[model samples]
Target: MNPDEDIKGMFDCCFTIFYQLKGFGEEILEDKLVHKLIYLLPESWESKKIAIIEAKDLKKLKLDELIGSLLTYELMSKRLIREKGKKIKEQGIDINIIALKSSKKHQEDSSEEGSEDEEMVYLFKNFARFMKSEKERSKH
Candidate 1:
């Protein structure tokens, strides 16, 4: 299999495990989750895999922390791939400096929009409770 395929497989495995475990009412033990995550990691992450395995307090690590690390790694890997692709495309061509700036601006805008959407969702979930409490206070 090619390197891209291997990376995709690793991402799929990690996301699947996260989705399965994240919904449970009880917390998954750190040791078991860590072992599973380490085992699921591809050889490309050799340094990280080694570091996680050799950590003195692997058992004490939280599941959320592990998941966050894995997610960040995945995002970084994807960004690197995108940058590499951009570099390849730029070769043997007159790169448009303005286009590059616009592309970066677009990425930043999209990220900000994502944060705003998350904030809206949080408010939507809590707004009803807040209104109910306000009504009770007004009656009392």
Candidate 2:
């Protein structure tokens, strides 16, 4: 999976590839599909991946359910990040500086081989924008 692409985009791309493979008499089982999708997720999604894997029988897990769960996780993460930023701003601290510093610190700390999913990077980008706009609103 490409970490730069959104989860939905990644799923769509995989489906397209699967369609092509079907023409060549290569058929992948729905059960195995779930495994591939979960395990293929970026390292940042490890917890969710593990949860999905352990909480249900792979043979019984539908593709729609997997995608729904992933999308839910993404949306929840975004909301939590936004809410945290808002609360920090209300505390009269400069969250923008903290966000930038922590993000950079994270990158510096991660090994070259370790990477986060697109969802996290997306959340951080949105959080930075939210903080910037909030600062501008306060200026007015």
Candidate 3:
């Protein structure tokens, strides 16, 4: 798979989820899913959409929802890496598990025990690093 396609897929998946959540109800814009979508997004794209989404005050979204989304995306990314490992190995390619682990570990390290917002904030800050690493792996 091309790196561009993979990045586009990630963007499309999160955007679709975000849009659906946005249309669900008045408070749906404040959903943790929205935060996770924002968190997973690359810095390149965040600036364009974040202003629109952040215009809504969603500070009241429960901690459980926020953390849940973070964990869900983490698990999904891990599973993708694991599944792709087999194909890379079969092709005798150098696998970059370090990058994947670093991305996930960064999430775990940054997330505080009592807050999801903090974790999301951390993710937003590191989005560029994560995207670069994933793109490299996909190219190999």
Candidate 4:
């Protein structure tokens, strides 16, 4: 699927959950959700993620602000990836394989530095899994 589709799906899923929680009178803490959302973002969003993490009064952060930042980063990343794909195509190389290779290389290179994004992604995935399971359970 294209990056735009993937990003829309992510946004929808997160926003749905947030809406449900709020509608149910649940106390949705800004800081915690913001942290999870940042972690849930792709590595290409490192700069935005870092900025959010470093922001003061994180507890007071608004959901709209987080969503806007994510949307901006998603669009920027999609454009960059599209441009890179075009370049790779002009060189007569398979973009998928190149992407896979680059992804592996990135992981390897960042492994030594203990990438916070990696850890955050892991946590975010686990949390998403949990949310999915909980949602399924609630359906029963």
| Highest lDDT model number | 2
**What lDDT would each prediction earn against the true structure?**
0.73, 0.86, 0.61, 0.77
List TM-scores for all candidates, in order. 0.44, 0.64, 0.29, 0.48
Q: Model 2, range 76-98, lDDT digits (tens) per residue?
A: 98899899989987987785588
- Candidate 4 per-residue C-alpha lDDT over 1-140 given as tens digits, one digit per residue, 9 for 90 to 100: 12445656887888799989999998777788876776887765678778887874567877788787777777887799899889988999875688797778787888654777778889999999999999999999
Kindly list the per-residue Cα lDDT of model 3 for residues 1-140, writing each as its tens digit: 12344444665666676677668853444465555555665654455346535654546655355445545655677699888988878877565575786778777877453367777788987997899999999999
- Prediction 4 TM-score vs. true: 0.48
lDDT (C-alpha) at residue 79 in model 3: 91
Clashes of each: 0, 0, 0, 0
Off by over 4 Å in 2: 96-140
Candidate number that wins on lDDT, 1 or 3: 1
Alpha-carbon RMSD, each predicted model: 14.6, 18.1, 19.1, 15.8
Give the true-structure RMSD of model 2.
18.1
